[model samples]
Target: MNSLKRIMVGLDLSEMDETLIRYTAFLCSISEIERVYFIHAEKSLDIPDEVLESMPNGMPADEKLRASLIEKVESYFGPDSRVQVDVQVVEGSPLKELLHWSKVKQIDLILAGRKFHMRGSGVLAQKLLRTGRVSVLFVPENIEPRLNHIVVSVDFSEYSLMALDRILDSALTRPEVRITCMHAYEVPTGYITLGISYEDFDERMKGFARNKFAQVLERFPELNDRATLHLVKQENEDDIGELVMVEAKRLKADMLVIGAKGKSAAALFVLGSVTEKILRYNDDVPMIVYKKENEEIGFLDALLGND
Candidate 1:
């Protein structure tokens, strides 16, 4: 599990900013986060000379934006927060600036707003998960700012283990917080070719999932009863991401955790199909897509000034 000592929160000055900032403060209070950077980006920092001259203190556009963001941060986090807080205003696309600055800071986790009915395209948050090497937490506009129960979407892949491991090792799992491992499985159509009945194949698939869960338990026996395995049967068009979200709703899960394709698609390093679907459909639950820091971003490393 990688320690999330430094986190970057992307702010676009929308109504989501309040939720993002307050939620960031909530996370900082719960986790071992050491530094938080609140960043806002603009397409251009250039202002007419007349407008600049008329400014009260002659502050640059970036500086003024920075001051406003600071007040917002201080309001939620308080002036004497033990965590070091910095507000940055940058030029260029918000998505580009966010990825670049997060890498530059070697940030551990990124908190981005998942807009439901916002003005922006709301693609930035999804793109960040797809393009960046860092782990990202998508905080929706409507959230309770509490994390009592976490649901990990598992396919028994390496990514699943990575997500579970991080949750198990993190300070966010303080005694009361529990982690649930949820897997969505389907009976392969090829089972018919193998002379297996649909019902038998379904049972077999579930048993295989249980065995995988047992392996997970063996790998992290410390998880013990704090985590339990749940396998859900997924039908055609049911969508694994949607199934996980449904399970989350049933469990009253506060946070959803899904792992990224690392060793398998290191070069591509994009969120898997299911993860992308979840990002699109989930607007009420705070979801985190976890990516290992050591994994290669492959071609993404040089993408659109990702450096």
Candidate 2:
């Protein structure tokens, strides 16, 4: 619903990829999607050398693979569906090719599988997160789709506001949709740290959180009538990622939304922490990461060079 007319599904040519493609097709069936691209990114070495010995056979093998993948997709969607789908095979890194094709083809949404064991701090996932051009939906293996309850994390940042606005504007928000907006506050403790009293710090933090919640509700009056607000106080936990996952599981939330800072290419390649932690431990629920855009920055932010 967020101008997502074109969707690109990243496929790995495996059973899991097939499941992801089918799940994506199911989601698109209910939307105004005009086209679906089934993209398979393969390493150049995967192409058989014997087939490549002759230029004609090399092209034939690639064409055959494409046709097979297309056939599988069509079969899963059934013959009655009117969604137009095309198959593409590219040679490069999977994430790189997906991002490049999404931009070049003007894709609005990207649907990809979430790897469970491949959960270490990786650059590929971070790169996809920083791609502000398209909205990404990660489908975890063996998880069914649910649109009943959603949990959105807010910290009074413009990125959080933008994410909340987008979710409210999407098709996911219907009369049956139940949304919970959560704000987590942490109180610093321990003698090894600063000498500030933990109790006093907690009280101040709670007051600040309450005021911020009121301001957020006032700024977006439409959400006041639709979503419920919840404030969580944590004294020992510092990792917001872990807290968010635990709370989502406790509430049985179908999805989680967070505001993320876009990291530079070099930083991402070296160590991707935030997204990696979330994806590794919270594979049950989908996450929608929102990054701040230039248009959302105010004059004050521009003066401070925060934009």
Alpha-carbon local distance difference test for all models = 0.82, 0.68
> On residues 1-307, what C-alpha lDDT tens digit does candidate 2 reach at each position?
4555678888776566666776777667655677888898777736665645534443565675676687788776766777777789878777667866876787766776666644322334445665443567766666676677888888777767877887765555666778898887776555327666767777788888888888878987867777887777755645666776888889888878776655543454444455556655677686766554432224323322344
Residue 261 in candidate 2 has what lDDT?
A: 58
Q: What root-mean-square deviation over C-alphas does model 2 reach?
A: 6.3
What tens digits encode model 1's per-residue C-alpha lDDT throughout 1-307?
Answer: 5377899999987788988999988988898888999999988988565644534465878787677678778898876789998888899988788888887898888999888787676678877876777899999887878988899999998888998888777678887888888889888889989999999999999999989999999999977778888788899878776777877889998999999774434434444577787776687999889997766556446665445
Candidate 1, position 20, lDDT: 93
TM-score of each predicted structure versus truth: 0.90, 0.78
lDDT of 2 at 67: 65
Would you list the clashing residue pairs of candidate 1? none
Enumerate residue pairs that collide in model 2.
Answer: none
